[model samples]
Target: MSRVIHVFRSPDRFIAGTVGQPGDRTFYLQAIHEKRVVSVMLEKQQVQVLADRVGAMLDEVRKRFGAPIPPPADEFTDTDPLVSPVEPEFRVGTMGLGWDAEAGSVVVELLALTEGEVDESVVLGDAEEGPDALRVFLVPERAREFVARAHSIVSAGRPTCPLCGEPLDPEGHLCIRLNGYRRGVHIDPHEAPDSDDDE
Candidate 1:
């Protein structure tokens, strides 16, 4: 699961982004009008939940802003990360309307990444169920045409990793056939201890 991060201009105006990179997962957001920016670093699943909520808000936003607005230019790289490399569309989530009709401007809520801890190279969760994960309300949709396009644009022309099957990290990687932990190889649990203690 990915994360959902929010950027709110007002109680009614808001947006969200999933938080994750090749290995350095973190949410980056900036609200130009409000003169505010926020970054949330959290685990994968928490972010996914938030995304679901935001998806629900899309309809409301559509009514106000008129059809889900195209993702802002600065939001993504020139080449989508999910395509060419990911092959299958890796749609993380959606952006839609919120049910705050009282304020009247279709509320834009994002299925976003929750707040977490971040470092220079990578963003990580405290534990599987720790507070590090940013909970999103919206879930990833099968058809994420918009997100696919955005990832490509933001990537600035980079390839995805062959091993982990994600976008490559900034430093690049070594391509030697690694032993002990091959993708399809299986070792007995009891035998694993002997190998570790030997070290």
Candidate 2:
């Protein structure tokens, strides 16, 4: 069964589509405005998966930045309302979908970000539960910002890991701490399991 998902959208503009199978990593993203059809295949096979992640990020943004407009009555069932294409305070823009049998490659096009534009290439993550061919990835601007800030923090040569209060070597640190209960691979894999067992 094909599942329809609202990938990214706001009070003014939105993007939504349906995913049918888990074969190709790509699908097609259709944008609607004033009841006109604007179709674009987001060449990447894992678009739906990426869209799911982006949707989650947007939810987080809405929670931290402020709040998302309450879902209108019958928001799910109601017909797509007339909306402007203006970028909203929300952190998502320019949605894409793709499939492999039809499209050859998964392509990502950045539309906007928290500050301005995002030009980094989207990287597909390792496959998970679903079909290997139906992978997903995204290059949200906020994520890039997180990376840039992290890099800045690392290069800034401050003291202690921002996440963990561990001291660093003169050559710099490699994130050996796990503030969010999630440690980097740099930590001893054997130690993680042993530590977890203790907990």
For candidate 2, give the lDDT. Answer: 0.34
The estimated TM-scores of all candidates read 0.30, 0.27
How would you encode candidate 2's per-residue C-alpha lDDT over 13-96 as one tens digit per residue? 223333333222223334433454333334332343454444455445446555432321211232342233422222234433
Question: How much does each candidate deviate from the true structure in C-alpha RMSD?
Answer: 16.3, 19.9
User: What is the Cα-based lDDT of residue 122 in candidate 1?
Assistant: 21
lDDT of the candidates, in the order given: 0.35, 0.34
CA lDDT, candidate 2, residue 167: 55
Candidate 1 residue 110 Cα shift, in angstroms, is 9.3
Number of clashing residue pairs, candidate 2: 14
Cα error, candidate 1, residue 195 (Å):
49
How accurate locally is residue 22 in candidate 2, as Cα lDDT from 0 to 100? 27
Cand. 1 Cα-lDDT = 0.35
